[model samples]
Target: MSVYSMKTGLSSILKAYSPTEREKAKNIAINKVRFEMPKLKGILDAVEAVNEHNNFQPLNEFVAYLREAELSDNDFLRLMSDAHKLINDLSPKFTNLVEALISLPWTKRQPPALQAYAEFYIDIMVAHNKYVQFGIPKLISLWIPADGDAALWPNGSPIEALKTELEAVHRLLDRILTAIPMSFEIVLEAIESKFPYFKKATHVIAGYIHSVLWLIEYKPIFTEFVVQLVLQKLVLLDVNAPRSEIEETDYDDEELEENENAEIFEMDDCPKVGNIFAFLISLTTTDDDVQPMKHPIAHTIDICMEKMFNFLNTKNPNLLNASAEQKLQLNKFWKILLSAFDNVILPSHNTHHVQFLLFYYCSFKNTIAEAFLTSLWDKIKNPNISAVIRQAAVGYIASFLARAKFVHLPVLKYYLKELCNWAHQYIQSCDQYRQNGSLKANIVFFSLCQAVFYVIAFRSRDLTVDRKSLLFLQSLQLSAIVTCNFNPLRVCLPPVATAFAGVTRAYQLAYCHAILERNARRKLATVYANDVATPEETLDTFFPFDPYLLKLSEKRITLHYLQYQASEAEEASVVAGHRSPRRQRKRGDSEMLDDVDDFIVADKRQRNIELARSQEREAQFTYGLSPGFHM
Candidate 1:
């Protein structure tokens, strides 16, 4: 009825679990049965019969038998589904099941282990059903994690074998993830507290997070929960120094005296508040997407920028360089650093020294608009750099780009130019690379970022918004796209886009929507002011010129494209060579200072006869007047 919490303990005895968990487990099973009632009866039958066999067969043979037993489509589905129920619950039966699962000297005893696993999974399926109908309150809390120096069990007890079982559970939690909730949470909690080596725990967590980001990225609600549960302990970020037996965080917390990883969780490790904020920041969310607001990932970037900057500043060079010296070995604190960095880095930007690094790396700077690309370039390009340092570079880059687009902000112009050139080279190299046998097909290989850039530059921020600089930018982007797709160009693109989905078409959609919606909102807010007020203000602010006597309507431009789709294709190109006419404004041009006398346009007719004749040389572009007439 009420949520089950680790914080609330009923002063238990030998059970290692609670009665409430058992009742909750029952509800989960009952609900699972109701949802898929037809398959539920057979599911129960299989769970009871799984132990009937003493002989073991290869998994393939077992699969064949399962098929022969008439359990193909829904039956297979329900069986898989049933497995979840058994593993999910923290009930008495489930607790006994966990005990059995961990107690096995080795689970390699063929059929028995298989049978036990099957029974365990069946419970998981039952639990899954309950969770769908209910929630975690009814879900099992099967794990009672023990750290490296764990309290010993009684003389006749059965937990000495828990070490192997815990290892299995660790692997299973990573492998199955949501399929085995209790195991996953319990393993994480134990690792959070006391694992012999942090590597084992970090590896599982990293894999799970990567898989979660890629596979279940769409399921923001669930992602949030998972990120929170796993990252919860990170909130106890010690801003000061690590003092205790556990490694210190990057910060010193006078409050808790606990060290913290500010990048992941930004709390004082006060259970209630620790991971909540950072977890909220990294929330598996797609909500602000509906409207133009900052995203969880943007907050992720901001938090990342702040924390990483702190760690970089405060950490001793030797301590930091140790990671580079060791390179992903014997380092638990830095593993989280590495994982988050990789997850957030772009493939294209391997280093900071590249001429156009800002084109890609600018977003990761202070702010998209304010990020000093030149300065950032200097920091990341050193050859002696450590791998984690590189990771920090990429994380800043990816998160920055993600944030700018999400917030409807513009990327800096210098980046646009370099990115264009980079794309051009990529496309041009295709033919040469193909002939040399070194070429690959995906140019935006890490083009998820490129795609978003294109959609923003080409589709949304088109000409008319600041002279449609994006059109030229788009031309460069399109050229790059075409060049990369071509096989004959002699260029190489660092291949990063293949594995990442959002980097391509999917991410582009996000870019398009964000820009279009932002533009639409701007239009709505300006409707009254633009239409009724003096139009001079709008024209001057945006165009910075004398308002046109006759303004061109967007419809006129829209209509031309609609009216002459294929017919004007060739005609469009010939005109492409010509620059569009621009209304001259006084402030921007440098030569304006030199043409003072020429800029004077006093009309000869308006001047007195004598003055008109005297000022005849300054009269320019006069209309409907005789040159000599000085009326």
Candidate 2:
């Protein structure tokens, strides 16, 4: 008979006999056989027979019967209960039965059937401990909705039905954990192995991430592991998704407004007309001179980042009014986040957006901010840490202090003093080694000095607000640090050095014009001397916590972010004379005027050069060179 005829005939046969009648007939046939056999032995023989024949008729029939039977059917419940008892006898060799059980649709079943299936699943794993390895993976596979179902919910909101199904999955997992406490490692392994690839559909990845976060609530022991895993994935996406790609994509305001409320799960529903990946790919084909492009993952990064930020914000909605218990919980959460930062985010290079999660979290309280600053300072001061990490740490500290609107003046001054004191001590200690040291050897000191200057340039208005603050700034001996023999002005990026010089000169805190003039002349002379100028050192700008540019998360960051603006002094000078005095030549002191003019011209020229170089390195650090650094 054809396959259709066979299926029709089987369906008719199943319909002809109720489960009760079938069980009674089975009993009668066994009695007539006149053979004494244990029930477990009979089950084993049936399984062996199925395997020998390479047929799954019995398994298929059982699944079909369960599907067709009513939830309250006693025969269905008893059959499942008996199968639960025979779980111990089920072996890997019983492939058909194992496959059938694994393939059962628990998600759509009624509560009683769902419970029965869950119990049988747990019993099988509990009976055969090794099955946990396979079973946990199967459960994890249900974490993401099927693609067709995801398409149905195009807005990315979790479907209520699917949510209920996932809740059942988690509860089943909870019971499995209770029965097999030692299977935690197996579950973790399964989760990691099944983690959605970063390039997968945003909803799929977000769904898995949401499930992982949900798992943390019930299994608190997995907090650190889960946090770190999520962060690692976020970092992977952040690093690959260059901010420039997003900026360069051709999108209109209406589309951006539409996408503003879009969740990670809703990325598929996002319009493809202005997609960064599509724009980039189009460029590749249309322009013969264009370089090959890496497909942009910015949308994916934005979704993941928004999810994480939401997760954290929900955990500590009102830190101020939180009770002691809530405070303790927040504290524990902070520790886990900090630890994850150190292990995953800290060491990472070229990550544009993931680090802002720490920034947003620290904004909750002054104590958290202070603690974060202290952590970076400790790392910056540690001589044993790698220079690269120390450099990145100092960059983070500077950016955090400059951009964080919540950091009060005293706190800023306190850290500024700390940084200046450290720079002073470092300059003094490195003075003896300065003669023999290469720029690479003392890069950390140069980085620290750059950080101090960058922060001072950013907060120049606050620093020189009054006599007391000016005196405090003067007392930090920034002049001495800048004028040190090490010559950090020349070693740091030109734009930062120029801004620091301009701010100090305007405030009368330091006289760096001469040093900058000298450095600029030397750079020019080196270029003239070589037929092909080879730079002695190439320093990529390191600003870890720059403007958070991910479109979806920008609102959260912008509220707390202190944007760069001209100081009152500079603004007034511009209003009065159309240019600052430092930019114009002085009346008396022709030599000094000449020096200032040369410094101005050279600063402008050096900026042009640096801009070109920055463009070259744009692929490596998209946000590294911010326009805010320019005076």
Candidate 3:
């Protein structure tokens, strides 16, 4: 077949067949073009013919086809491996095709095509730097003092060598930066356009951004610029502004404003936009070397912090009142913000920045605590919200406490006390609670208790100093956990032989306390051994309401034994499976608790009667009006 005939045949088949069927059609077309039209090699003349024909309309459909099709291994390898036979190194046809692909409206293009161009761009990069390699020695050589080192070069003056090295680094970096021009832009657009469906693509773009920042030096002119870009991206600020308001005067234009207005931020954008935080962390990372290479900029950190604070300040109404789906999005943003706080923002070396953060945290500490706790309480109280959403809210509240663990201990303690008091009041108000009936209020109270326990545990882990206050706080924390995990069983004269359900929980809580106590006590013994005044004084106010807990030194050990026995029994039962229906019930054990209420009432009556009889015995004093002989 002639070249014209082959081209027409290929076009017809591509147009006629489905994307999945096009591979077979492509095979037939390739054979015809390869064998029959020997004058035109596979790639060179094909690209030239397409350009000469001015037929670019089919490229879009071709891109769509590539996206929809998954070629077999053999065909894919053949396509890749045989490409060298088709191209002439001297020809500019391949270059022109690449340029055309690059210059196309990438944001409008399909991902597969953009990805294909990305691979091509990488190939071009490899071709450009086929002999060059950037290493630590090269980077260190660039930084060497120009006038101090003569032997560093041996070929020329230090200045000349430095210049050459710097140029080489810049050249290599520039090539890398420009390799996939506007491809990331397209990816970002696609990410936004496709929303949650293209999350993997979002990660891919984020990974690409990370690689770029990692491979290149942020020194010289790019540090501040890149930092600002990354910070803005995190906050979803696409446009860059000047450092000063005066300098920023010319930033806003009609087109820019229009584009800004056109931009829409959806819930799906959270993870993609939030990726900037991870990138920021990477930027601030350092090695163990005496002179670390890079550090996060103070100003850049300020920008990100302000953005986050502003976001939190404005507040998401949905955080408090939202549907499950809306809550999911809000929670996702919260997770990202919390992660950034723990990983980057809280650990920042900027004193003023950290102070500004602490200032806000301290000022609004009560308000924040109130908001989050109230939201959580409301969720648990609400019957309309699904169990999953309510449970998620509980989890979110726990995470919020963790994130805000840096709040002053006294402030946190005050909030916790308030929460406990409120819960206590709620329980007291319920008639069912006084009657020894199961109370729904216990759920909210227990959830709050659990939150307190988690916060205290976190604080214990984070506090390692040997200060007197640390010891007090440590004891207070352990007491709080013990109290929170305490089960409410009325201790009567009969001493009901019941299994303490909270034994296992208490054991766990006590273990954490033991860890804190061990560390804190050691520190006190080592540092404050000579300080008699400190050792003699003890605060009773910080202790839990239950004195038995403090007296039991081997409580955790005993609980561990009981827990092991219970687990062993449970495992044996599981192995035994079902038992005979005629099995005997244990003594004092009610198979149906509700049915045993009559017995409980009778027991209570008996106790009351006994108390009255004792009073009557003591009432012999009532006959004192009579002569002493009458008694």
Question: Which number leads on lDDT?
Answer: 2
lDDT of 2 at 277: 50
The lDDT-based order of candidates, best leading, equals 2, 3, 1
C-alpha RMSD of each candidate structure in angstroms: 25.4, 13.1, 26.6
Per-model CA lDDT versus the true structure: 0.30, 0.69, 0.34
Clashes of each: 48, 0, 0
In candidate 3, how many clashes are counted?
0
TM-score winner between candidates 2 and 3? 2
The total number of steric clashes, by the backbone 3 Å criterion, in model 2 comes to 0
lDDT computed for candidate 3? 0.34
Tens digit of per-residue lDDT, candidate 2, span 361-471: 888888888899999999999999999889889888888898887899999999899988988887777775555456688778878788888888778778878889889
lDDT over C-alpha atoms for residue 524 of model 2: 57
Which regions in candidate 1 have their CA more than 4 angstroms from the true location?
A: 1-340, 343-412, 432-459, 462-464, 468-480, 483-631
Candidate 3 lDDT, 1-631, residue by residue in tens: 4567687775333345678788888877655543344322333445444567755434333333333344454433443333334333413434443333233332223345434433443454345332122211222232323333434432221245344544444443444446634333332332233221111222222322332233324222333333333333433311121122212232235633453343334223374464455456444543221121111122223233433344344435334556888666544544443344334333222122222232233234354445445555566557687544444444344434434423455655555555455545545565344533232334344444444443343333233223543454444444333333223221100111011111122223233222222333443564467764232111111101001111111121111111001222222222212222322222112221111111122223334344434333322222111000000
Best candidate according to TM-score: 2
Task: Return the TM-score for candidate 1, rounded to 2 decimals.
Answer: 0.23
Better of 1 and 3 by TM-score: 3
